[model samples]
Target chain A: MSAMIKVNLDLLLVQRKMTLTELADEVGITLANLSILKRGKARAIRFSTLAAICKALNCEPGDLLELDKEAE
Target chain B: MSVITIMLPALLLYVAVIVWLFVHFKSKIFSVRSGTASTTDNRLTRLVYHFLDFFLMFIILVLLMMPPLLVVMTISQFDNPEWGIDIGVFSNLRIDLNEFAGLVMEPSGIRNPEFSTQAVISIDTYSLFAYYLFALISVIGGVVLLYILLQLRTVFASLLSDMALTPENSGRIRKIGYAVIVWSLVNPFLQYFGGRAVLRDIAFNVPGFQLNPAFEIPIVGLFTGLVIIVLSGVLNEAARIQKDQELTI
Candidate 1:
């Protein structure tokens, strides 16, 4: 109840040297939606979308998502 | 008062309410920019909705005119004393038509049978009042029904494209079902009142003219309302699932 998942998509993109727009295009999602996900405002991410993002960024799901146990 | 005088104000009131609703829901109505590109591949379903759109409009026109028409026709009969109103009193009367059939078969025996066998009553002032009352009830009921149909048209127009289950559409469907149920419950009382109004001044002791509340329950309407209510539930569930699926991406 006190835990929440956070997206480290910005960090992953930085490490992968990929632009947000480029990642959005490669993942076949709108830039606005991608920004929402990157800003950690999304309620949940579909596994398929996460997989697509991971594939586009050349990273694992753990590299993009993080568990913030104390954020809540 | 005359039927037209009684009906005109009610008609105007109904129109005002419709206009108010349109103004209130203007944003929602305008926001429906979706085309008729339905998600379903069934051509038959598309055709049915297309037909319904026109049919609903025609029904609205007929409903609007019916009360006035009834009044006019009745007044004509009232004015002409020679052609008295032929009020049919129906019940479980078992008239043996076997003799009439035999007489008709034999041309020589088939003398001009008395067409005045049924009572032809003069339209008195009380009967005219009764007719007006009946027409008023019918008009009000019709206007309410028409209002619901117009609302339904708006709902359908908005969701013309991809009528996939949504919260708005589900709510509309639920409202329609509830409206129908209310109409069904109210209709019996209206029928009883109208029947009483018609029979209030008839001098003859007609069998079915008793001032009793013998209105039959509108079983078909009840069934339709239940079906729509169930459909609304199904639509809501479908909408939830669709949202989840869309999020699943």
Candidate 2:
């Protein structure tokens, strides 16, 4: 099975009209951490952290992330 | 005082706590049944809450057993001074390789070498075997518990994505995250204090070995705990927003 297409968190935030600065402040995460998450470079995400991000952005995790077929 | 006495009271207190949780939750269940006001149709919430309750019960049981385990180790060291094969004399204690090996190996044997000592203590090989088995079980149990919690998080996130984010839910999630962070911060300290106390009691017998409690105070535990809680919150919020957007579309 192909690896799932992960969410582009940065794009999601932009589409939701949420500034990175605002999201970072609301999530209580360092700007650096938020940057890492947006860039999809984070090694892992905790359930709680994901929940906070969703709550702040007013979006579902699936909206930010999705499963898609990998290129052959 | 032996470990048993301490454990008896602790066990009773733990049981009381468990009973209180049950009663409180049970009352909630009754209200849910009788009350005309119901908001959500999700059975997953109930499942998650029940899972949390069960996990807490297991944690309490593990906590209850810790003192007895420490006491057993202490008594074992005392009976077998040679059990602690000193590697060197760091401070007043004798440091020996054999003793260190014995600490990990025949821990109980080093304590009560005589068959006349309590049957459980005297059977050192069996005791070690049992300990190894229990440790394995505990590790597996922890892994399974973590997996279940993760699953619950996924479910919560999915459900939240479908709903609008009310101020009440937001506040509740924040409070839960704070509680989790606090618990994580305190846990290591408690473990260190408890471990140090047990080790100090046995230090007289294990001459070379020192109990290092310094590693317990860093923000590592709290950080991880906070991250987990925050992630859960993010997922729920994301779910809610996504749902609202879909409805709008």
Candidate 3:
């Protein structure tokens, strides 16, 4: 079974009217590394980083990550 | 006259290479001063390192041309009316004086009539071929090791900028380690065959004399390679950790 973790970070950022650069600064992470996470290329996310990102965006972890079982 | 004709060009070329390397390193010394001081920053160490680098390269270049030289030498030996072949596998071995005495004590009928045990040994074509083949292998191994060292010089140059722990440098270290291990593994056999080739002309006809091949194992060389391989892994891990830290925020 093919599985992919879809990051809804962009959607949350847009809802919060926050740019990736601002989120990265609040989360204390590099823009490039944050972009990697945002693009779903990260194999696994650290709980601390996830916590920081969710805190920065004022959102829950579930709102940021979801398992996509079906694809077009 | 023919020897002079052949050697003069080679001699002139070697001198040119030496001059060029000296100038190249001398120019590099100025640039190196602008960079951060490395482990090999001092004038003496740089001089020794560059000298060794150039010397190894010269040796490797000479070695690369050995197959042709061996062919010519083998042909000359073959054409030499004074020396003839001492055939058989035993012809490639060295026998001791005790073994000679023992051989003489053996039954006279058992000895070959043609092989005069007391004859002065001169290399035969077949032995030269074998010698050249093994020596060529050893030389190739040396060439690979020298090339790895040359690459390491670049890695060290990068180190002067305090950027020594990159993936590329770590990979170069691993390559050097691997090259050393390979050379160490092949060297013993090369020594054995090379020794045999060198002694190709000495006929060991001592009655009952047996032959033994000499072996030279590079245990220290093997250990050095293994240590370098481990250090490369450590460097790679350190680089990874540094990248993670840089990405952390």
Fraction of the true interface contacts (Cα pairs closer than 8 Å across chains) found in each model: 0.24, 0.00, 0.05
The local lDDT score (0 to 100) that residue A39 gets in candidate 3 is 74
lDDT of 3 by residue, B1-249 (tens): 344555566668668866876776666444444453456455555555555666666666677566665555455556455644443222223344343544455445544323324322334444555555555665677677677778777775665446777888889899989988987887777666655655544464555444444565679989999999999999999887766655442
Off by over 4 Å in 3: A1-6, A24-29, A42-56, A65-72, B2-9, B30-61, B64-138, B150-174, B204-212, B216-218, B225-249
Itemize residue pairs with steric clashes in candidate 3: B103-B207, B103-B208, B104-B207, B121-B201, B121-B202, B122-B201
Tens digits of lDDT, candidate 1, A1-72: 213887898788888888999988899999888887777666667889988988888789998888897887
Model 1, B1-249: lDDT tens per residue?
A: 555665576568668756755665455434432454545543444454454555565567567667666655666455455543333221112223343664445445545532322222323343566656655666777776776776676566555556547888888888889889889998777766655556555554543222232456789999999999999999899997877655433
Ranking of predictions according to TM-score: 1, 3, 2
Candidate no. 1 TM-score: 0.64
lDDT score, candidate 1: 0.65
> What are the per-model C-alpha RMSD values against the true structure?
9.0, 18.8, 8.1
TM (chain A) per model: 0.89, 0.78, 0.90
- TM-score for chain B considered on its own, for each of the candidates: 0.59, 0.37, 0.62
Candidate 3 chain A weakest ten by summed lDDT: A1-10
Q: lDDT for each of the candidates?
A: 0.65, 0.53, 0.67
Better of 1 and 2 by lDDT: 1
How well is each residue in A1-72 modelled by candidate 2, as lDDT tens digits? 212546577777778888889888998878887776666545456788888888987888888766655632
Comparing to the true complex, what docking class would candidate 1 get? acceptable
Q: Can you give the DockQ of every candidate in the order shown?
A: 0.24, 0.02, 0.12
